[model samples]
Target chain A: MITVINSILTILGIYFGIGLLFGIYFFLAGARKIDPIINDSKWTVRLLLVPGAVATWPFLISKLFKTEKQ
Target chain B: MGLDYQTILWNKHKKVYDKLILAFMLMYLLVFAGLTFTFNAQTTIETLIIRAFGTLAVIMLHIILAIGPISRLNTSFLPLLYNRRHLGVSMFLAAAVHGVFSMIQFHTLGNVNPVYSIFTSNLDYTSLTNFPFQVLGFVALIILFFMAATSHDFWLKNLSPSVWKKLHMMVYVAYALIILHVFLGAFQQETSPFTIGFLSIGFVTIVSLHLIAGFNEVKTDTKKSEKDESNWLYVCRTGEIEEDRAKIFTVDKERVAIFKYEGKLSAIHNVCKHQGGPLGEGKIVDGCITCPWHGYQYLPGNGQSPPPFTEKVATYELKLVKDKIYLNPEAFPEGTEVKPVNC
Candidate 1:
């Protein structure tokens, strides 16, 4: 039972770590380009969105790096 | 934009959308319940409602997600996008019914709180086959609750559209969790090939639709242009853009909409201030560029909303040489009064 609980804790830690990284990237860079509406959002509001930002990073990444054709 | 908010800001179109949703949900519940009761008379009512609403919620979610890409790929499907929030809220209601009933039936009457049992009773985290599926559903439900709670324009305004949109994008996370919930819970208990096949087909259909729409957008974004000068790029001929409409061009990674209205031409950032909707897709309504997504209007020249509204988009300089439209790749600060050129 202890082993099962430890395994769950480890998995959750890794999951949240990845989510936090993506969330930080979204806050620093992707938010402005992906959606201009969020450009002036408060820091607290931005922090609240970390979990969602992490979850939807795949779609947001495509939009973020999408550049204009010269 | 109104001061007071109703339970639902019902209009003729919203009424129609709600009627269709109700009719579909009722039809689905009746058919599913009827079939279950007929096939297995011994199945309890709680189980029947759980299955019926669970399936309906998932189906509505697929429809909700599909509507975005479908509308983007084909403008004819825009009506579906207009009242999509109602569909999302309705889906959450259905899922809530399923979740509540399932909790009452399975998790209640145990030694602990019903909600507590949902997480604690299922402790087989290491084993994929016997994983805690209810935990997945619980997490998904919490996400859906937040999404549904903030589905109104009031929240969009208060939270700012960017934060609201990002928060709602958690629907994809909820979707993944729901998929895992069904696969691990029901699929394990019920080995019916029909159920498995149905879920697989729905998943494949959603993935394929998104891919097709994404590829189409990529084609638009990657369109090549001929540069005429250092900061100015050639857009298209004057005749190319229809009166009261726009010809959107991507220059230096920024989208610009060149509009022709009343024998005058203007260029502005393609992205709308509201919800990042594509302003180019909108037409001139009463001499202002009206966003198709929500009818948020902005003057084409200065890219500022009319009096009493403060929304704005960046404007660009436009010049006509030999009937060809040339736009400056550099954008002016938003709401700069760049006068429209006579065409």
Candidate 2:
């Protein structure tokens, strides 16, 4: 039981860890493309996006590429 | 209506609202602690903190849930709805504190990770009373944390309003989990009539308010409209709609708001671009139909936001004949400029 729980936790950890790295990159570069207003938005506003970005990085990645294609 | 986004677009009203929230939270915590210590002198500081925050979060969750229905029932409660995200975040913060402190106090001495221990610390999955309620709470906290993280308009825009709304609706799931957690964990051990009664009352109140408000909304949506030979729906007379206000009706299963403003009548989609707020519930402010929930405004004529703001809603054609209003059920595309009919 512990092993199964640990496995789930590890997978979640890895997912969110990758998400964290992607979040940083997205905030620094890609966020502006998706939301042009972000270019002029305050750092605090940008900072507020971090947790959401991390949680939904896969969606963000797809959006980034979609925007790039556009 | 903002050209740029800040961390929070603070106004005097929001400041006052937040200050009131802070004062209320502090007073509640102090009172809870004082009462707990007076009644149970043997209670540890950790237990007091855990119980205090846990109960506070539960109360906050009940209030948060109630606000939606209350606002739906009465527009006067709409101001509370505007800053509701702050209350949600505050509730999540309180829940997180209770969860973390409880985990550390109960599970930190184990060999396994504390989070992992939440599931493994109690093996009794079959028993009703011995169920690992902490696990339910941990899961609820995760849901609340996710919701709190994505509560900003940034997520609403990026994820799309529909998707964001769906994701946030997981609050119902968290609410269920927390209810089970309290019943199985705290109530099982403490067995205090007061605590049990409080939880029962909160749960019943939230549920009853939602049902009442939901029935009222359904009554509006299910209203039948008379139709002309051309299939234009017959709405109420122009006089029925108050000046600068709207009379909402169901047009082809979609809600449409017909506003009477400055001797002209115009119709637009009732749902706001932001948060799906009911535009009909909001009065025309500054010559624009403002959303009651978030103040998202749209031009009465074009169903488009005023200059520098790009949000828009679908417009419907309206005809005013001898003070009788008729509406074409077919909607033009969002941002379509339909001419308003003079009343």
Candidate 3:
């Protein structure tokens, strides 16, 4: 059970990380401009980072180290 | 100038959070019924307290998320604008419980170092699947701690609005971190689709509201920018303004208030420096422009907020362009001499 949980956590971490990266890209690319309209795209895209980083945790654990129980 | 959005949302959301905190206490009663039956007497206390705090966190998250939209729908909600710090601090106090109790329940004692186990236990910061939810929580909590500590009006009085606004914007960063923490740390373990869907819906609703508000602001500002003319020419005679009352004029999206005191005419931004209350209608008290709402006093010549509150507003260049009394829309530093409109 511990091994299975750990594997899942590893996947969540990686998947969320990808989302976080994408959110960051959107934030950086759109946040600053003379025209404030550009910032909206950044904030909308940035919201994705929260759920993405969160969902990837289980997968992240599996890749980081060998699960002792596995 | 008017009350900018940062203050507006801050105000309305505060009332929402106030009502939210009160409502949260009622939920505390329902949970107690379950705790009494399921757990042993001692474990009941621990479990109830810990879980109750988690529920409080969830409640706070919902309130914080909801505040952005409720405030946008109304204008009278502006007074809540001044008390935003209290709301934020209250939210932090609620979140603190989850922060401390989680440590004691899951990570304290045993063979493992509490701090080390936080990063190591089932979380891999480097791995995509388990990239360390606890660390994000840790970082989020630290930022919350800083924000709560500095939420005092004392800080607002001392720090420039630009500096203070920049620091407060970190709440968005903290929110993102907390979002990840919950996803990996809690929902991952529970595996409840209902729970996951609820949280996702909550997040999406909030982001959509903020985006809509942002767009609304863009549209409003664009309209204002277009309507306000390049120059405002006034036909004021030399002694048109009086000492007790201010003559209000609009130029290039700026509200200019001309105050005549002791034979000199000084032009200042009509918006109050403290809360953006209209200064034109405000009474001149003790030789200063006092905001009617909060009594924020500013020296008219310099537009500087008086002692104990460091605030300022833009001062316009006053020029008598012709007998027609032409006023330049361009503003100058406070206390500097500019040509005046004799309209």
Candidate 4:
């Protein structure tokens, strides 16, 4: 039971660690590119997006790249 | 509106609403603390903190759940619905506090990691009475955290309203977990009549409100309007609709809002682009159909948001034959301008 719990936590920790790194870049640059309205948005709005970005980084990453390809 | 972004589109009303929330929370905590200290002198400060915040969070969750169906039943309650996300986030914050304090006080004493300890501390999952209630709470807190984190419009736009709505619906799951957590953990520890009665009342109230609102909506959905000679579905007489307001109809299994404004009638999707709010319950404010939930505006004629705002809803064609209004059941593309029928 302990081993399974530790494994699940370790995987979650790693997943979120990668998400954090990706989230920083997405908020700083990728967000504006994906949504033009975000270009002139306030710093507070960008800050507000950080946690959501970190939580859902894989989806945002796909969206970011898709917008770039276009 | 997806035109611009701010941390919060703070208005004077929102500011007042937030201030009221803070005041109520403080008042609740103070009263709870006073009662606890007077009655339960033997209880330690940590237990008091955990119990107080836990009960407060449960109360807040009940209020949050009730707001949706209550607003549906009475448009007068729309103002409460407008700032409901703030209430949700605040509930999550209170729940997180309870969760964190519980972890530190109970689990941190052991050598194992606090989060890990939550799951393994009680392995008697088969026993209903001896079930690990803290695990239920911890899972519920994670769901609440995800919800609170994505509560902003930024997430709404990015995730798409449908996806975001689905994600937010996890609140029901969280609510269930919380009810179990309180029942099995807190009630088991101290079974006071007042606590049990209060919890029962809160649970029944939320469930009843939702069921009533849902049944009323199902009536609308099941109402059949047969097509006339030209295949135009029969709608209510022009007199049935009030100026600046809409009468919703279920057409082709989709809800449509037909609005009477400026002596002309227009039809659009009943669902708001922002948050799936019922646009049919909204009024025409400043000549735009304003959503009752968040005040997202759409021009009644074109089903489009005014310039700089990009949100839109599907429009339907309305035909007036004398005093009886009829609608073409087919819908035009979103933001399509179907000339309003003069009544």
lDDT for B291 (candidate 1): 90
Please rank every candidate by DockQ, starting with the best: 2, 4, 1, 3
Better of 1 and 4 by DockQ: 4
Query: Residue by residue across B57-134, what tens digits does model 1's lDDT show?
Result: 999998998999999889899888888988998999999999999999999987877766777787787898999998
Give RMSD to native, each candidate.
Answer: 9.0, 1.7, 14.8, 2.0
On the 0 to 100 scale, the lDDT of residue A16 in model 1 is: 55
Model 2 C-alpha lDDT per residue in residues B1-343, reported as the tens digit of each score: 6667779768999999999888989999999989988889999999988989998999899999999999888878889988898899999999989998998899999788888788888877778889888889988998898899898888898899998998899999999999999988765677778777777888899999999999987887787889988999999998799999999899766899999999899999999988899899999999999988778999999999987788989999998768789999899999999999998
Residue B242, candidate 1: C-alpha displacement in angstroms: 1.6
Which model is ahead, 1 or 4, in terms of TM-score?
4
Question: Each model's interface RMSD (Å)?
Answer: 8.6, 1.5, 13.6, 1.5
Model 4 C-alpha lDDT per residue in residues B256-338, reported as the tens digit of each score: 99999999999999999988888998899999999987779999998999987888899999898889989998899999999
lDDT score of residue B34 within candidate 3: 67
Query: What are the per-model DockQ values?
Result: 0.04, 0.72, 0.02, 0.67
- What is the overall TM-score of model 2 with all chains considered together? 0.95
How do the residues B1-343 of candidate 3 rate in per-residue lDDT, one tens digit apiece?
A: 1221131223465577667655755566466546655664555555666667655666566666556555655645544443444566677877788778777777896687564566567645457556777778877876776667545333333343455567678889988988777777565566767656767887888888788878865554344321115455562655565675577676654577876665556678887755456777666787887775566777777787766555777776555543323455677765454443334
Please report the candidate that would top TM-score against the real structure: 2
Relative to the unseen true structure, what is the C-alpha lDDT of residue B6 in candidate 2, on a scale of 0 to 100?
79
Give the Å error, residue A2, model 3.
21
Worst 10 residues of 4 chain B by lDDT: B1-10
